[model samples]
Target chain A: MYASRTTQFIVGLFALLGIAALAILSFRLGKISILPTPGYVIYANFDNISGLKPGDEVDIAGVRIGKVLGASLSDNQARVAMEIDKGVQIDNDAIASILSMGIIGGKYVSIQLGGGDKTLSNGDIIRQTQSAFVLENAIGQFINNIGQSGGSKDSSSSQDSQQSQQKK
Target chain B: MQVVEFIERVGAYILDSILALGNFALFLIRSLMYAVLPPYKLRLTLRQIRIIGAESLMLIVLISTFTGMVLGLQGYHTLHLFGAEDSLGTLVGLALVRELGPVLAALMIAARAGSAMAAELGSMQASEQIDALTVMAINPVQYLVSPRMIAGVVSFPILTVIFNVIGIWAGYAVGCGLLGASGGAYFNNLAANMSRHDVALTLYKALVFGVVVMSVCCYKGYHAKRMATGVSRATTEAVVLSSVLVLAWDYFMGSILL
Candidate 1:
């Protein structure tokens, strides 16, 4: 029952349209690359990665240069493997820090370019790295300090009252 | 005696359902075997694609756009409560690409093309056309069922991709255009949060839903009783069963994939 040429043409058109839509979803929206971008791998060790994930961005001074490939435990620290684009050269003494995108956003690795003359090559480990800031840890430390100071003040006030009573 | 009769009736009902399930499994396996075998009916498959895929395109586009727009509106209001309106894009994108796009598109196609498949095949069975094909030394399953199955498997993912793309853009139009959320944050969060895994999930769900829809609809119609009332009943059963199967399979896949 497939007699009409018009139907055949429309079918072909529809197939092409579907393929085009798939291409857009895969490449544009999904950001999937068939061929991995030409890049070199480097390693950085952090004490805590916080909420940083493997697919998070690796940036140099607010400019995204690559992506985090994966993270694993190495020598009691989080060893993160990052794929940096070939053109961008990271200095040997550069500092890598985990920075959040916003108040309630994802974490990314940011590199502060170092003044060292030698540049890091593939497989080089960045020695200077900063771990992600844990908000809970900071709050806990603050509360502990407050508690200690309050207890010490109360003890000193009691000691002063006892001395006055003894003198009287 | 009355209690024994009731127990016997329940046992018979359970056995009847088990037999029906076995029949469905065998029918699906036979159709799949025909689909993969050589001497592929490319012309008939194309015709089925034109009917199932091309005809449903406009309906998919319209439904997806509205769905996206609604997601954007709802997401903005909800996230705005936490002062996270900028995440509207991420919410819309993830919701559509991961879940709504495939499921909703499958349901729509099930309602539109799936019902048509059932009614057409049911009527054909009632009219003795299927018998005539069998008598003419042609395998009715291969000639009729395989092509439609192939069409469904091909069409579902394509329609889902179209749904996701259009839906996300429509969400952007509502969230950024109407709600005045920062366009950059919306898109940036989407890009940052979404991954290849999410996109793959969308396509996978579409593929499974496609198979479920085609098998259920075709099975019901193929075994339809030889009567006018039987054809109508088969059509109704096919639509309801396929839609329900699509949803049920979606839940299973989601849990497994996650």
Candidate 2:
């Protein structure tokens, strides 16, 4: 029986406040963009993405400008669709590289902006891409080179002398 | 003969479940259609929102804060073993936003507001007030059920967003303050890793859970038998059914959405 007009008004006010709180959460905490403009999508192909997955950030000069939408295989190469925010322009020659946070960290895509007269449009493919660094491959190559050089004692001694001279 | 009896029972049970599903679908569609139709009870809807949403705010905030704090603490210790303690922020943020925030918020609402809504309706049914409304040329579904359902669907997602924000803050406090983790790293990683899509998906889950909670609870209460014990049983069933559906639907939605 709490049907008084005042009670209704008060309840309405409370509900409005709850809605305001949700808006704040969306804007401040969730970082949801309220812009109605749909962002542009571009594709980048890489030979090996390492551990890069969808939802990973796409950063340009350490600033995130886009996110990986999805990944697919095209002609034995990994194809990633990236959704970049509107008003941000990408040059046709921009390089997409899969980067790690740390030595053994999560993977993300880094975009090195290019200075080209022509600008990339929606659905444009970025041809120049660098794969993520493979730790095992680098270590294996290092060990292989060491094995190849280990048989030459004279050359190894000469290199050691040069390293000691540099230290001195 | 016993085996035949068991088969008959199983068949009957399957039929009953299918009938229940069809009835629920019809009820949901009718209620939603009423929501869009005329004679909108703005005041009643607001009152329901107050009862369903505002009343449950404190419990949501309290539970979310503690959930966030515990997640942060556990994540910090676990990630520390791999020397990736800084990633705790992203871990906590993603977990709360993606799964825990919507599921736990819905479960809480189902317990607090959903159960209460059912009990209220069940009592009203037992007292024949719903029948009285029908006698007065008013559709009980439109007047009683529609407002509650609309309020529930509107309130739940907002509550979920509040839960997520509070949980993130709680995680920040415990992980950065107590564990000596860098507050900067905690927030920075959270901001960097969590995207709008994740938040949007979370809101979608909350919306679906809200509809499920209201429909199941309201349906049970609306059709409750006209007896003292029947009303009580209806209330219990409403809570149990809605809670179980919330969890099951969460899994299905996560598999598809995520």
Identify the leading candidate in terms of DockQ. 1
In model 2, pairs of residues that clash are none
TM-score of each: 0.89, 0.77
Clashes of each: 0, 0
- Mind giving the per-residue lDDT tens digits that candidate 2 earns over A57-146? 788887778778889999898889999988889997788888887675678898988786788989998878877777786666557657
Sorted into a CAPRI-style docking class, model 1 comes out as acceptable
Return the DockQ of model 1.
0.40
TM-score quality measure for candidate 1? 0.89
Off by over 4 Å in 2: A1-26, A30-99, A108-131, A149-168, B1-4
lDDT by residue for model 2 over B61-147, one digit each (tens)? Answer: 999999999998999898888778778789998999889999999999989988888888988898999999999999999999999
